[model samples]
Target: MATINTAVLDTFITLTGIKPLAVDVSPVLRERKAALLSILPHWEGAEQSGIFAENFFPDRSVGHRKKELDDLIAQTGNVTGSTEIKAENQLRGSFMLNCPNGNIRVFFTLSPENPPLIQQLDFSLAK
Candidate 1:
């Protein structure tokens, strides 16, 4: 099991302004998502090794997570469109985004104290 680089993770947070809770880097390797690969120089070896590209989500290295994400991108074209909408009455705090090929539903477990805003940024080109 490879370990995630604290320094690299810190840099990522600083540049993206988002805490690294979880991440998917599979798309970085694909031609469609290769542009994102430049942002992460630390993952070069891992990406070539085919660590996460072949494996699924589990307790593993950041490189593996990226590989898995690339695989996911291969399966799901791209996050085409998204919308910030309210959740159902039953859910305490929930939000969802509709991608081109799929939808991401986020359920907030924490209270409404300084909720994180979901911003849409184009990270890759669609296929």
Candidate 2:
């Protein structure tokens, strides 16, 4: 089993302000609701027969994409800030969260399906 990265998890938790016990947002998390309720917990958990269970070997190397986000941030200066654009098949959102760190803008995409899936996640920090 792939061990969780505490450093990365901590940074994310700090950025998003997530509380384990307070994660009961199944009602508002439309996409998360489908994922948590539809898929059998065992599918993502252990006890798979290996024949049908999908397994993933994780990697944190995302330099290429990070560079692209860097470019976008450069293009969208502080004046531009954040924006959300929704297309027929896609829902895109970008925002500057209230982080202790200087201005930070994050861009993400969600599928237009009933239970949207996060197809993309990118972020940039103001210089």
* Number of the predicted model whose TM-score against the real structure is largest: 2
Model 2 Cα lDDT, one tens digit per residue, 16-35: 98876522223323343233
Model 2 ranges with Cα > 4 A deviation:
1-90
Model 1: how far residue 48 lies from native, Å: 27
TM-score of each: 0.26, 0.31
Instruction: Give the per-residue Cα lDDT of candidate 1 at 126.
Output: 28
TM-score of 1: 0.26
Residue 119 of model 1: what lDDT? 20
RMSD list, candidates in order: 18.9, 20.1
Give the per-residue lDDT digits (tens) of candidate 1, residues 21-125. 432322211321232233332345543433232332233655664565555455555445444423332212333334556544433222222332112111232
